[model samples]
Every structure is written in structure tokens, then in C-alpha cells.
Target: MTASAEPTPDDVVSAAKALHALTAIPDHSPRWSNTAEPTQWTATHTIEHISDALLFYSGQVARRADAKLPVLRDGRDAPVSEHLDNVLSSAHVLAALLRDLAEERAFHPSGSADAPGWAGMAVTEILVHGTDAARALGVGLILPENVCARTVSRVFPWIDLTLARPPELLLAITGRFSIDGVHSDPDWWWQSAPLVEWDGLPRRRDVKPGWT
Candidate 1:
């Protein structure tokens, strides 16, 4: 968290590349038995999920000018190398798209108000999910507190950032913890998209409908 403000498009792309490099390291040989933190997915499965998520995010930005979001598919049955490559490629493409259309407003199910906000969500995904994969691999990776803080400020503005460290705060707002007797569950949602009359309010999509 070394950044001072919302991360630029370039920062998002750079962080994603760094994450890919971390997950691409060859020494995590025994992670086959390790389960990712707070999830049933294994280390390998988590990495693949990260890549698949990047594609999903990419589709969100790619269709910024369209009324509907593109349907993205899972990265199933793919090897580690292939997953890493897809993540790297998708990150770059999404970053470039955001940079080029920085001012464009998009309709995201997550409710992003602008193109850059969607990019912020992508950055959050990299830092948070990257940590998930790394922890499962028994490694430590710290995203800059500033970047993490900026993401919280942008997407989850209702979160009380002063109450915890950047990483902990990020996890807390994302429903990774139950603070002060408040339980995290499907009702807990991030402010991914912007508010609109038709949308009612910005909320996480239902898991029953392929939200995972």
C-alpha cells in the first residue's frame, strides 16, 4: 500500500504482471495439498480462478460502450502455465482498454460508474485474490497499502478504512471477516458499479446465478 491515490491504468497492469510473476515461480512445488485461505479451492485452482476472473473483468471493460456485458467463461482444465499466460494477457488488454476509454461510462452488473472504476475493481481482484493464491502456496505477498486503500476508497466507500490496516480492511469489506458481531454472508456486497434508478442500488450479484 505505497500509493497515494487511486491507481492508474498502468498501475493496475503492473500489479497484475507482478502477481503473475509471483504465481509463476517454480518453487511452489508442494502446493498441491494446500488449500487457499477462506476458500475450498486449492492453490492451483485459485490461480486458475484468478486468470478466469481477469477474463471476466476484461469482458466488463471491453463492452463498456455496449448496453450489456459480455459473458465470460471459466478457465477450466487448464495447466498452470496456460492460466498464467491468460491472466497476463487479459490484464494487459483490460488495462489498455481502460486507459483508452478512461472517461467512458459502462454498464457493469457490479455497477461501476466509469471505466476507471472498473479498472479499480480489477486491481482489487489482483491484490486480494493474489494473496489468496500466495497464502495457499505458503508464500507472502504484500500489495502496497496505498493501492489497497485507494481501491477501498473507490469501490467500497462505505468501509471504515480507519479501523484496520489496509490488507485487513480490504478483506473485511469484501466479506472475509465478521467484525463487531456482524456476520459476512451473501448479503454483504461491494459497491462495484454505480447507482442508477434502474439498478435500484449497487450490490453483488447472486451466487445462484453463476456469480462465482
Candidate 2:
């Protein structure tokens, strides 16, 4: 979140492991006490979506500078177990690439992103979708404040760090919460551009220059 706490490959790895705990695959038991948040999709569908996203991001991150992005496989029809594996494998691959070349810049969505940006994005997918999966399983999964804060720091650098709360603010800027006058008629879109020197404060979409 701070200069000393920039996200790394290890951060992504740990978030993946947290997702594993939510799914209850390895333990072979139901964890109704998930303690996380919620989403609209079913558990199976949500997990599948996250797995595909993880794979896709891995593909983009693995691309060399100026290299074309690779086509990734769709695992939506795979069993939930396989989807879980896909999530973990892709996360590991992304982690390795980020670990090696985190500082190297690459184009994503017409803009370049640094290593922390990638890592934060991956963690966001896991934590948010993982919470959805957990909730559909009749459990709640609350993310740690530090993890949520770090994720915001990376992807949503526009957030004001001073007015932060763990999942509440995370969900708000992620379009899950309705912040007054902030604007999310559809949903809040996170920026993927390099934000190395940008001010870490909330940006209001409805406010305009010389209007207020």
C-alpha cells in the first residue's frame, strides 16, 4: 500500500491460498462459516469466472513488451474442482512473471501497468469473486483490512487512503457500494494505467472543473 508495502508475487500467491480456504475442496468439508462478502452469481459460476479471468490476466502479463497477447483457454465448463486448479495454476504463473519483471511495463487496456498493478488486480479478482463463491455456499468471507487496503493501493490508486475501510471502501469503489454522488450508474471501472507518481486520493466522477 505504501512505498515500503508494494505488492509482490508473494501477495498474489497468498490471496490464492485464501481462496482455497473458501472453496472447501482440499478439506473435504463444508465451511458455512466463510466470513466473506457477496456477489450475484452462483458459487460454481463465480469461481469459473474468476478462473477464466486469472488465466486471461496471466496470458496478458506473460506477454513480452509489445508482443501480442496469447489466446487463453476457457474453463467455464470445467468442474468446479478443475476451475479451482486453473485459478491456482494461472495465479502461480502470473506470480512468477511478476516476480521476475514486475518493474517492466506492459500495455493493458491501451495503457501500461507496473508490477504492483498486476498483482493488485489479481488479488482483487480472487478476493471479490472468492467472496461471491463463499456466499453462495451459504458462508461469509471477510477479507483482511491490510489485504484490501493493498489491493486498493495498487489498482484503485484514485482512492483516498485516509478515508479507507477494509472491504466497505473496496466494495464501494469496486461498484458494489453506492457512494453518494460518486457515480456508478453502471459500475466503477478500475484504472490499469501506471500510477507511479499519481496522488493517492479519491477522484469524484460527478465533479467537474469550475462547476462546484
Candidate-wise lDDT, in order: 0.64, 0.63
lDDT of 2 at 58: 68
lDDT of the structure predicted as candidate 1: 0.64
Which lDDT tens digits does candidate 2 get at residues 122-194?
Answer: 7878877776667657655667667677777667766665554756566666666656533333334445456
lDDT of 2 at 35: 30
What is the TM-score (0 to 1) of candidate 2?
A: 0.74
lDDT of 2: 0.63
State which candidate has the highest lDDT. Answer: 1
RMSD of 2: 6.8
Report the C-alpha lDDT of model 1 over 1-212, residue by residue, as the tens digit: 33356556776776577575455556447774478777777777766776666677667667764554555566357656667677778788887877877667666555544754776677767777777777777666766666677776666665566667766766665566446533345444556554232344335555343344
* Alpha carbon lDDT at 197, candidate 2: 55
The TM-score measured for candidate 1 stands at 0.77
Model 1: colliding residue pairs: 1-144, 1-145, 1-146, 110-193, 111-193, 111-194, 112-193
